[model samples]
Target: MITWMQRHKKWLVITIWISTIAFVGAGFVGWGSYDYGKSSGAVAVVGDRKISVEEYQREYSSLYGQYARAYGNQFNQEMAKKIGLPEAAVNLAIQKNLILSYADDLGLTVTDEDIAKELVKMPAFIKDGKFDKELYIRVLTQNGTTAVAYEKSLKRDLLLQKVESLFDINPSSNEVNNLSKLLFAQDDLSIQILDPKSIKIDYDDTILRDYWNINKIKYMSTNSYELAISKLPFVTVSPTEDELKEHYSKFKTDYKKEDGKIKSFEEAKDDMIKVLSIKATKKDALKKYLALKKDEMKFDATTVIFEDKLPFSAENINEIKTATVGDVLKPFEGTDGFSIVKLIKKIDPKPLAFAMAKDMVKADYLDIKRSEKINNIAKEAMKDFKGEHLGFVSRTSIDKIKGLNPNEAYGFLNKLFMSKEKEGRIDLGEKVVLYKINSSKLGTDTTTQEKSVKDILLRLQKEELMTSLIKNLENRYEVTSSLDNKE
Candidate 1:
């Protein structure tokens, strides 16, 4: 059986790459503006919970300093600036606070034992193949982190992990199998060549104006605010030349040392050899598979499928049913990856086999259990709940809620708003979320209403633009980076 990591190796690689880039660029800085001393420094405010400049700066500096030390000369001030380090750092701090706030609200607590257990798992604290308390203290001291602070951080991380786990949606065995089949299934013979030159758009001013008007919401101006806000005075903490020298001497080794522990050649040689062998084996296997596929091409017909119809033919079905080793069918176009299937083995699709789908089934069951648990928690919380009615809250209104998707919350809100006074509960696809509508009101001010609409429109446009850019880049570039194989 493939390990979860192995099964999702490609996704893992992509995730790692993205994470590495983000880590390097933003250095784990959460969402917010970096200009903390400025009036616009505050990224967000949850009620009266204000994230201040000093707090953001301290966190950012600490995180950035750690990153610089970890990456040594590879991490420079210029690079940090380019990545919007100040803003990223502030955001990170804000997000941490927000998560902790939510965790507190949910009554989530971490024990000392949990912190200790998590600390032991950290590779930095390990020495000579075991947890080393002295080494841990020494390292933390070098990094200017106290044991108490580290423990707090560990506890927070653990709590956040738990909170995130609460939101985990495990795909069912049927879902997983269906997804796998869609990913690996072969396709019938087909060719599609789109010619840009063949396509034409009329260069009419009337048409352009019509299109612009239809999407004026897309390209409209926002009501920009003018402010006479005052900034907090900068608190300077300068070190003397002697102090700087002392500081450098004390922590210079920490920065000079490699990010990870260095293993002896003998220790890593076997693993390195194994990795190389696997690569060679995969290369040879792919070559053989491709050759066999070319030789075994038995289809002599072509068929076209529309956007709304199935792409498979009778021959394609038969080929898939009888698929064996080295038998390659036509390339099947998918939403993401193209599939050129070469069946390793064939199994009769029968009643769900326990051995084959046990993990998937377990995941599904766990997801269901988690959802039920959250629902029960929410239900208990709302037992005597009397809340003001949200007339028509959009997805953004419930962004503060944990264990809930914005879209899901939007749908729930819509249902709640539409339902009669007595029908307080609404089904949110997977589980029921109960909401009480306490009051309803319509806006009178056109400017404020227009501003709200414009804000939403701007946010939507930015999201769409970013998504399109990312999609285009992913489609064009062939990114091949494996964390497991990284040197």
Candidate 2:
């Protein structure tokens, strides 16, 4: 099955970075301030606009709390700090502000009715088939949301979604079909792999001594110290009761509602009417487009015999049979969207006979047989290996294991680590050659205390490398933070 990311690669890449920051607490930070009248302190200031400190703290707390719930005991303050949770929250705030600003600039507006309709779709706010005001209030209150504030946020979100949809243009059918084929095409290759163990490595004690001496600095021990760290207090102004009341009053219009059972006709009547209208319009549009296409092709559908029932109207079936090049069918509602399908060509579906499918089955069988053969070859190659030192090593430490292929090191790490000390070779099926471990250590030496220092340095180096790579990629992309730009 194709993943959501695979289906929407461009959008996935754009949105995933922001999502990652919200979840993993790692990414960009921007200078910005949020202002909500008299109760505001600079959370961050992008340009002239201020993001309130309270708002920043609220967003951070919610995000981090969610991460803790998902990760459970693994979530710790140290991990949060390491992943730059504060920075992530700031970046998310900037992104949100930017998107909202863009929507405002474009004069995009979402009506109160639009928000209400969207709210009905939220499972938490719904009971049976109707929107449940009590459940809605309860959930929002539990999440520290005031009715007015939550609605404003929801409105902003809806506006952003509208703007995003405006940019959601569909590719031409030819383009979509070409892309689909590229994505779904399968390749069959007859591959032969040579086991690395088949290559001999000459090991001499003198050579080991010489190599160890020249690279002794790389294996040195250093003094180590363990220390405990604690967080220091940072000052922040607290909101008074009067201030909270004032803030609530200013935004209260967003939350005003009447109590009692809502008649669907009264609450969602407009929404239902709009939906029905759109459906009717689409049906009419399709019928008109199909009639035009049928006239162009001058073809009759009476000759074509469909073995199975088609999920289309009689007019739609005629349209498909008569569709010619360059004619566009009206959009028909599908699971994802209103699909405007162009009949490229109608190829008759035929059931594969036994003889027709025989070659395909034979090919699949041979592929499996080849994989098994590769595994057997690897086992036979390592039958006589013996060494004083053995055991599992990290994939990155392939150099430490003699007569091993660095390229295939990752495949063997788990097997080598899990292997019990034995005389014979360990066989990993399907071209993966395994190594036997005679002895093992945690890559640590208690006697010298030097191994710990070396390990720490190595870990730090790898982390630094990863950080640099991420920075380079981020720099290459034009990452604009609304938190910094919004006035």
Summing lDDT over every window of 10 consecutive residues in candidate 2, give the lowest-scoring window.
224-233
My TM-score estimates for the predictions, one after another, are 0.32, 0.39
Top-TM-score structure, candidate number: 2
RMSD of each: 27.6, 28.9
lDDT by residue (246-323, candidate 1, tens digit) is 644553432322332233344544434444444444454455446546664323322332212333343344455565
lDDT digits (tens) for residues 131-184 of candidate 2:
899887875654445567667656756765675555434334444444333322
- Candidate 2 residues lying further than 4 Å off, grouped into runs, are 1-39, 47-49, 54-72, 186-188, 195-205, 226-487
Top-lDDT structure, candidate number: 2
Model 1, position 155: C-alpha lDDT score: 61
Reference-based lDDT, each prediction: 0.45, 0.46
- Give the 10-residue window scoring lowest on summed lDDT in candidate 1: 14-23
